[model samples]
Target: MEITIEDLPGHTKASLSGRFDTTGAIAIELPFNTLANERRALVIDLSNVTFMSSYGIRVLLRGGKIAMSKGAKLVIFCPDTAVSKVLTRAGTSDLIPVYPTLSAATAAVS
Candidate 1:
């Protein structure tokens, strides 16, 4: 699994791929923690992500909480139905905004 971070003007995007859960926490957290240092707004891209668990959803929600605590907007994009289901079931979607497209997320953050 890989989590690649890209810096945007007012936010950051973490491109997530492969299985994202307890097993991939380190990889995911590295980029997320990077975003926490400088940027307040964050957008996690899930276009390439194939698998997710409750722990993966926790990562997203936790990141969201951190971003929001810094007076930021935390948006998640391109989450497939399977991944979305996990967050939905965990009620994480209620806290984090899920965008169907990167354009929408980028627009929101920008």
Candidate 2:
């Protein structure tokens, strides 16, 4: 997996590609947690992600909770159907809003 973070005016955008499995989750935990701890709105772009595991859901949940507690927003964008199904089945989609487009995701957090 690859994680690329970008700074937006009011928030941070993290673009993720490849599989979001245990290894991938571990790889991004530090950076992702750090960003969440910053207490700023966050946009996670999952358009390029091909797969998502339960571990990935856990990481996202943790980040979302931390961000929410700090009054920061966290939204996901463009997850592939497979990953989207995983999130929805895991009820993660309910906790973190997922948008079909980057514009929509950013708008929601903004």
Best by TM-score: 2
lDDT tens string, model 1, 12-96?
8878888887888656676676575558777888888877876787777778777777887778896557877776777877888
Please give the RMSD of candidate 1 to the true structure. 1.7
TM-score (all chains, Cα) for each model: 0.87, 0.94
Poorest lDDT segment (10 consecutive residues) of candidate 2: 78-87
Supply the TM-score for candidate 1. Answer: 0.87
What does the lDDT come to for candidate 2?
0.88
Residue pairs with colliding backbones in model 1 are none
lDDT of each: 0.78, 0.88
Give the poorly placed runs of model 2, Cα more than 4 Å off: none
